[model samples]
Target chain A: MIVFVSCIILFLIGLYAIVTKRNLIKIAIGFAFIEYAVNLLFALIGFKRGALAPIITQIDKPHNFVDPIPQALVLTAIVIALGTTALMLTVILRIYNRYKTFDIAEIRKLKG
Target chain B: MLFIPLLFALPLITAFVIPILGKIYKPLVWIVTTVVSFILFIIALYGVAVTQEIPMSVYKMGNWPPPLGIVMAFDSFSAFMVLMISIIVFTTSLFSLRYLSRFTGQWKFYTLFMLMTAGMMGISITGDLFNMFVFLEIAAISSYALVAFGIEGEELEASFKYMVMGEIGGLTFLLAIALIYAKTSTLNLADISNSMQVIRGTTFFWMIIGMMLFAFSIKAGLVPFHTWAPDAYPAAPAPISSL
Candidate 1:
């Protein structure tokens, strides 16, 4: 339960960073943090106390094993996070190149 | 039956093929995208007709049965969405053929467009929650890149802002999926629906529903989350904005 609460806290912290931080890179880092926190929570969800890895060697043996679905999901989520992170960083680089600064306050071309 | 998978597969295959075909001939990219989208539109029409006869059709990927493997559920609603997507994609591709002549990297635009089409189609037909998320990400990522395709100052800034908010919504969705899995121990939509009956009106169920609602509202650009739509729509090209 503490771990789950910590995960929510981490997610909130990342949300705070994204909402309050002015730097483009810091915002990207916050997105990464949120991704990691979600991935961690997913992986932790399938964990079982004293359960072995989900590997079936015998047909009739009744063995305690952790749920493997969340593990597979985490792997896919990690790959997606990688793609989003790379794309975000590339966009940030382009933004910095055009604006000559990392501060979001300085880049205000699209305003209300 | 087969038309359901081809709705997405044809575009996905052509998306990768266009980049290579572009290396050989530039105009081939436009030709191929137009042809593929037209064919997809035809297939969607066929799908709608078929679903009209058979209201619900299920295609189990790799012959895996329900609750075990990913399934594509093609109902009348999915057919309607697929038809709508095909119409929009075909029209947009036709419009962009001339509209994108001024752009230097035309092939990249078509590739991303096809990917987005496939993603949206997959989302419509998929019966698994995780598969929907994957397709959603595929479409969302492609849109992010497409929004920034011009590489201009305003476009890049708008794409960045849109991406941050979108990712936050996506993460919240993943958190909800995790909780749902922990409670139901299943990711298949039908299975989850069956199991969710017992837990209906519970706090946990409401939490999951609320999280999903929040995520989808961001995707749909509801009132509170409409800020990204205004910026992103204006930043993208006319054809993409239409899509």
Candidate 2:
């Protein structure tokens, strides 16, 4: 599907940012983008054409519903993404305070 | 049997309790950490003995069946890993008691260490694919914070680099899990393994395998993914690097 392909493309874009960008903040943003893309892909996986929200109200009535598992998984994934993103930003902030730069080239004190 | 959940629960509960205890009395955190990890090591030993007696044991969360709920599958391999993890964690906590005296926020180190232990233990015992991912993230995130515990420029930079690479691998893993779930319609490891047989050798199967391989190889620091490990290991403290 086009949506799935777009998700992969978004992920690739994030990867590209991480690999090529020199700014620490940009790289963090790239990681956020990647997390969002993956979470979107997971949520999209459970989407149904005409299915209703997965809610059961009556015992006798049967209703079409979208898969709820992926939705739940996405919620967990989002929380994890938030944790990683916050940590990444915090580290970046510390790096800026110590080195006084955002450029990766200038930040390199450890080398081969 | 009940020791299976205790493997993770004990450390997790201790991790949170450490910080609060640190507020009351700083040295109490160290004592609690040591006691908890020692208990965990014993539990892991029991797990190994029990698994040697029984081939496999399953603990259904909330009394739900395998296909419908998350389960903890304890087998020989899991027991082995759990034992290995506990041994390392116990020794590391002991080592840190003296090693971390120079550090101001030693309580944070023990907290993150216990959390990482819980995460690794959860990963080893979890029977659901998503549960594994959650535990993986928990461990990975704590390790990232641990790597940056010093707050030095180089440590922060290394942690940043490691986080980027690690998150990429983790997201790739999530994508693979999504694909697997889309195909199998189940998240339980046993259920998915049962359904996967029918789709074995298919292109989709291979794709998922390749993605998972890529992700795990990064986690394991395989040849191509070895860059982050060298930097991360050297930047972290001695015990954490060893861990």
Candidate 3:
């Protein structure tokens, strides 16, 4: 409910940053912010009212366990985020090397 | 049954193996990749034939059933996607042999290209939601590197922008999947769909669907997200750009 709405709000804020910002790195970070917000929202989605972690150490019957599927899925998504972040940073570094600036406006040699 | 896994595994294994052989013999990069994709294309044709008979086939990994284990399901649609991918990869590899001569590190190109192919195949055939996300990342990460293969200023800029959009897309998709899983308590697409029958037409359900649609649109470079597509394509090598 409220948490989901807040998550959407956070995503909108990131989208706003992307739309309004001019720095290349800032825009990249804005993208990362959106991802972070979404990941948070995902984890929140799997939250239970009064549930324990969805793990089984012994053979006892579990009570009110949180869903494990989204947790596993989020772990995989985080790994993906890490890879994309590293790659984005690498590309940004190369862009800086060639253009000598991080400003999106200044790096517009591809302007049509 | 076996062919489904082979469709993903063969290309992935070759992606890793090609880079090593490439260090020793350069020409083998083109030969190996081209032949592998051609074989995959043939396999995809066989997949079509097999599916035509059975109509729908499911291959569960580790012999675990759909609700617990990952499965690869092939029907007309997935088989068609596989066939399309095989054709695209085979032609791209063959063309890259002549077209990529001007580019250094041709072996790296073939390696990443095959990796992307493997990822695409994995995405198309997998019946599990999370498995699709993982494969989508594999394809995306490889493409990000491929787009920046030239390492020019514009190329790097474009690749960075593309990576940003793609990561956001992936995360949004994960959010949607999480929402679905929270409601359905299942990760299998078929299982989720079955359970969804009991809990349809809710606001939560529609939000999940909307989020998924938005994510996929970004991935596919639809109108709102098409900003990265134009810049990234031109930045990549000509052969890869065509791909």
Clashing pairs in 1: none
Q: Evaluate model 3 with DockQ and give the value.
A: 0.60
Report model 1's TM-score to 2 decimal places: 0.99
In the range B102-124, model 2's lDDT, one tens digit per residue, is 88988899999989999999999
Candidates in descending TM-score order: 1, 2, 3
lDDT of each: 0.91, 0.91, 0.86
Q: Name the candidate, 2 or 3, with the larger DockQ value.
A: 2
Model 1, position B68: C-alpha lDDT score: 91
Clashes of 1: 0
Clashes of each: 0, 0, 0
| DockQ ranking from best candidate downward | 1, 2, 3
Q: Positional deviation of B176 in candidate 2, in angstroms? A: 0.5
| Docking quality (DockQ) of candidate 2 | 0.80
* Candidate with more favorable, higher DockQ: 1 or 3: 1
**Which candidate achieves the best lDDT against the true structure?**
1
Q: Chain B, candidate 2: TM?
A: 0.98
